[model samples]
Target: MERKVLEVINLKKHYKGNKAVDGISFHLNAGEIVGLTGPNGAGKTTTIKCILGLLRKTKGRILVDGMDSTKQESKYKLAYIPETPDIYPMLTVWEHLKFIALAYYIDNWQEYGSEILKRFDLWDKKDSLGRDLSKGMRQKLSICCALLHKPDVFLVDEPLVGLDPKAIRELKDAFKALRAEGKSLLISTHMLDTAEGLCDRIVVLKKGTLIMEGTIEDLRHKVNAGEDTSLEDLFLEVTEDEKE
Candidate 1:
């Protein structure tokens, strides 16, 4: 059996009386990419933050590589890219890579760092400080940092938000390569088409509850949608009650 990279069991988070995440559970297996999607206010971000230990969970268990996710050791095996890229303003593009390498204790990282810069078309901006880069460049830099250590699992939120067409294509290609190497990924995005094409399975949330989980075909079957039904339509049909 494939090793489970991450497992969330009966996870819950709440504020006052608002249940941001209400007893949701799922797992990402080695080499699998699972899409976590939901409408606005559906608890997607809360779920992710809980898993990352950014927010204290109201209840539940999160295991990363068979260890408690809140533990420091588990963090070493995980990487995250949020909707907005956060980088040190004084650090040059190249410095960011070096910083990551040192933090991850990567030996002989120079060649790999250089290759990553070139792959993302950021070689020419290597000396540019983070403050000098545009939104797209900043996003690219974030991607570079996240992948530099080659973590066992990746949790990306709105990864394509600021990427240009070329960067988008390159990032997608990189994700495919990571999967080929047996890394698990959990992608959270509002872009249904991208998720539909990239994910092995999808977990949907509505008002802090998991409404569905399955492949595109499996989802179509769950909703009684035709085989040709698009994910966008499926999502709409499943979450239509939210807007009512």
Candidate 2:
């Protein structure tokens, strides 16, 4: 059996009257990419943050490589690239990489970091301060930082947003390469078409609840959709209900 790199069991996060992430469960295997997708306010981000331990979950458990996600060892095995890149305005593009290296205790990261920068088309902007880079550039820099540590699992939110065509292509290739290296990725995205091609499987959320989870073919079967039905169409069909 394939090893599970990440697992969320009966996960939930609730505010005073809001069920941001109702009971949901999913697991990501090593060398796999699972897309977490749905319309706005669907709890996609909440689920990810819960796994990252950024926001406390009101119920349920999270595991990283079979260890409690709150453990230091588990944290070291994870990396996250949020939808909105939160880079230090005072740090240069290259400085950000250096900081990650220091935090992760990665030795000889210069060569690898240089190659990553080149791959993402950020080598030329290495000296540019984070505040000076555009949204796209900042996003690229955030990816580079996340990659430098070579974590076992990656949580990427809206990864394709703010990226140019070439950057988008490069990021897609990088995702494939990471999978090849036995890394697991949980990608939260609204870009259904992109997710269809890239993800090994998908987990759909609605009103903080998991509505669907399966391979494309499996999802098609669940909805009785024909072979050519796109993920977008399938999503609309499953989430057509007005009431939660």
lDDT of 1 by residue, 1-244 (tens): 8889899999999899999899999999999999998777888888888888889999999999999997899998898888888888999999999999888888898898999899878999999999998877787788789888878998888788767888777678878877997988899987888899999999998889898899999999988999899999999998785568
> Over the stretch 1-244, how does candidate 2's per-residue lDDT look in tens digits?
9999899999989999799999999999999999999988999999999898899999999999999998988988899988789899999999999999998889999999999899878999999999998777787788789889778999999988877887778778878987887989999998899899999999999889999899999999999999999999999988885354
Q: Each candidate: what lDDT? A: 0.88, 0.91
Model 2 misses residue 165 by how many Å? 3.1
Model 2 ranges with Cα > 4 A deviation: 119-121, 132-134, 241-244
**Per-candidate total of colliding backbone pairs:** 0, 0
What lDDT would candidate 2 get against the real structure?
Answer: 0.91
Candidate 2, residue 190: how far the Cα is off, in Å: 2.1
